[model samples]
Target: MTETTPYDADRARFTRQALARLVLCDHAVDVADGAAGLVATENDPDSGPGGRVSQAFQLIELAERALASAVIYEREQGSSWAEIAQYLGIGPAQAEERFAANLEGWNTAFDVPYRLDETGRKRIPQLPTAAYDPAWACEKLDRWAYVQRIGIDAVSSGLVMAVPEEELPSVTP
Candidate 1:
């Protein structure tokens, strides 16, 4: 017999990706802090003084990549402009503009041989379903609607769900 839970599959995938990102972040920290085998220390007579500075630069570059990757992931997961803006602590218009600019810069700098289709347009993959259960997907739809209804920027990091205050059951205790 097999057991299933509403959050199992999605949570597992999210947990794996989240752990990978954390590992990258931790490595960045280790490099920047001169821990681990990131670079030779000054105690080593042959080591150069530029080691720490270069490692710090690498940390910044890795952090930038992590942030960009997160934004792209959120977008592909059906996050709205407002949700992204809220996460970034910016306005929706600014978020959209900045993301577009960043996407262009990323493509220009990182895309090797230019990944385009036969029509000369960039190829975009079809998005997968957000959740396994259609009923659970309804909650996500409601959350999106709630975000739109109030016209307030709501922070969403793809892990937490924000239930409306009214919908929450009152506790007598």
Candidate 2:
């Protein structure tokens, strides 16, 4: 039996966000490097001061956004306010207040895959298509694999656990 728990969901969410944060930070570094080069310009007036300065400020803005995302990720992973506070080097109340302030306009939107019954039947209907969509069935199987990776109970996905390969309709040319 696949083991599923709330912790698994939280962990998967955290993993996804962490990857996004890494990519954002990497971009910030690239931006800073470009700005540094512009700052060293000998004759280009446009690159002398204004350009690099604005880019430098952008680094701060990106860092702040990344920090807020981290806070949200931690919370979703079942972290206590006090724990976050300790990580931020602030009191629990202050941590909560600051995080809330930062996340005021944040959106935690995400997509959920369709559920499937144990007999490899789709629990949710696929979106409108001209004909039977094999890709939709493939996507459902992918979702199940992801659930398994996250240690979440596949049963929570719906009825049966996995989609049998034979259940997927084959396309004929």
Alpha-carbon deviation at 37 in model 1, angstroms: 5.2
Task: Please list all clashing residue pairs in model 1, or write none if there are none.
Answer: none
Q: What is the C-alpha lDDT of each candidate?
A: 0.50, 0.51
lDDT of 2 by residue, 76-106 (tens): 5678999989988999999988888544433
Model 2 misplaced regions, further than 4 Å: 1-48, 101-173
Off by over 4 Å in 1: 1-46, 102-173
lDDT of 2 at 44: 47
> What TM-score against the true fold does each predicted structure earn?
0.37, 0.39
Model 1, span 46-112: residue lDDT tens = 4378865676677777666556656655665567889989988999899888778655643342223
